[model samples]
Target: MKIVNAKEAGEQEIERLLTKAAFDQVELNPKIREANRKLFGRDMSAAELVRQIVRDVRNEGDKAVIHYTELIDRVRFTPEDFLVTEEEFQAAKDEADPDVVASLQKAAENVRRYHQEQKPKSWMTYRDAGSILGQAIIPLDRVGIYVPGGTAAYPSSVIMNAMPAVVAGVREIIMMVPPKNGKINPYVLVAARAAGIKKIYKIGGAQAIAAMAFGTETIPRVDKITGPGNIFVTLAKKEVYGHVDIDMLAGPSEILILADKTADPVYTAADMLSQAEHDPLASSIVITDDAGLAERVAKELEKQLADLPRREIAQASLDRNGLIVIAEDMRQALHFANVSAPEHMELLTEQPFQLLPYVRHAGAVFLGAYSPEPLGDYFAGPNHVLPTGGTARYYSVLNVETFMKRTSIISYTQPALSDVSSDIIRLAETEGLQAHANAIRLRRK
Candidate 1:
């Protein structure tokens, strides 16, 4: 990727580049708009497909689930053997490396500690007039977590996604992951067992989501679903939202670093590659005020790219979406960062604390070069399941709250009702809802 100086670029040129840098578009401005219009005009075929899957699984029960699992994941799993048995768990536990298991144990403890601080306590208050109001913080009855188990198996994902629900006092946590050639990954099975997951289902893709949302004969319905997946899996969550609560319709990963001359180019480049390696759509952007610093970071990116196991994917992502823009000052750099609202923001500068006040949006902010994105991804206490594709402007990282629901608690005494009756009737009458007005007025009478 070419290093561009933001201050030197003219208004039109900067605008064009910024527009191009955005993910919602690929081509020129007019072409990008046209493409968006075309995409939105199309039918909801994907949603329709999900609906059909939900209907079939709900009606046909375990039979349709097996059929879809075979058709989608290309794995044969009879209902009898779909659930992970005690023997399988023991074998997986025995198969996992001792050091790896120890690391997972430590990470799980950290995750639990961080999330436990987020737990909500129920509170109630009674007034002198005999009115009481308070909310009860209760975990969902059951929660389903979808972990990707294809070319890679993330035991860390299992720990991060399920531990919060477990700590929240969820009744049961059922984990669904695709099996490879009808066999689940030993490490994943070990992780699930270690995390205290009771039910592990050998199924994945949109089919698993449907079963979790609507419930089949074998897989029980869950009150909430949480985890990250591919595009198809994310779209499925969007479709099944009302059926069950979902964490978020997450997109590809992203990271934006605000670095200065004092920052380490090698560390910044390595962090960018960490996010880019997640997927081809991932973005790794660095905004700095020094042209020389930007060039060094780019060089470090090239050096680091050669060492990555997923270099092909990460290189493609950087070539397409990655950028190094040199700004006139740190303030200007931060302005662009806020506009991007990256899922991960690394403030790799001498004055990271000062910059923290300027950062208004981001899923999580990594304070210094030592605090890398992967720390939060696996070991750090905060959630790694973050909002991506600029959704950080509105959404937040997953936490214990994701697995819990809230209801407003409202109670009013006779005096309270009588005091507000006239104003309520006035507003209700203005809206032409006499029934609503009468509901309050009758209580007063």
Candidate 2:
């Protein structure tokens, strides 16, 4: 990991250090290009390849999804094989470990309760006599959630993404996951079932997103798509934004810790490695004023890395993206964290709550050493699908409102129209909207 003194680092150097790993066409890795060459007999960026796949699925529907599944995933499936049958669900239930299933059910209940509190109710108020202005909260008719598969199965993702929609009173929640050897992960299936997800599809990647956004013969079109996936999936979500709503353009996981001498070096190092193990692109950074604590955390990271099952990936991530900065004081460390706008931020200072008000940008803030990032990821009753790539400055964690739509309600009696007609006409005329002015003029007449 790189270590630097923030007091001595130039502003531009700090900015470059905080910049996210770019996912644009120009940043396409050699492996992605190699895959494109093997698949298409030509070099193509991930964005271009996603565009082609999205276009094919939009135009060809089920046939295109099947074709891409065979070509990209080396799995052949007909329309009938697209949907996971009740038999498969039952099999997954039977095959799943009873203890893990029970634990998932408990986690699902926690998630369900948390999101239930976030559900918004429709409300109205009559401020003027004979006039009604309000908002109607309506759950989406159907939503599609994409759970990542292949390298690993994320059953927790199913719980995190599905529970919010379920709590929002969505009529249907459709889940899609990549299949391995023509089979979806039993744990994922068990999690979906526990979360009240009725419909499951054995599909993944950009094609799955395209299928949901545009709809195939077997897959119904969804009003929105949520959950995280690879670059192709992210690009596909970007392409289909107007056609369907998406949660956010998620990137690799990240965590930043602001610590002081009082912070436990062991706990801080474990928290950093938690995010570092997520992906090779994942970033784990620490900013502290205590030089001795910084050195201890560094040594602790080395000791912890040896025991992690994903040590190679974590080590690569720490080597390439991790950083330890010696700040002048706590104020400077907090400033650095705000500028980064990390997906997860931990306050390991002596008085974490005292610094809480100063945290301006972070998807989620874990206060003190006890509140580890993984606690929120698994069972803390908070959504783990957070904004990445500094998007926490604007984007938010997935919640009930993400699956619900709000519509403005307007009602005006003849008397109310008469009261506002003149003002409406004046505004419309000022804007040179003759039709809008005429409509109000006729109403008055």
Q: Clashes in each model (backbone N, CA, C under 3 Å)? A: 0, 0
Residue lDDT tens for model 1, 300-362 = 999989878999999988988788889888888888888778888999999799989989889
Candidate 1 lands at a TM-score of 0.89
Stretches off by above 4 angstroms in model 1 are 8-59
Q: Which ten residues in a row have the lowest lDDT in candidate 2?
A: 19-28
- Note the Cα lDDT for every prediction shown: 0.83, 0.91
* Highest lDDT scorer: 2
Model 2 C-alpha lDDT versus the unseen true structure: 0.91
Candidate 2 — which pairs collide?
Answer: none
RMSD of each: 4.6, 1.4
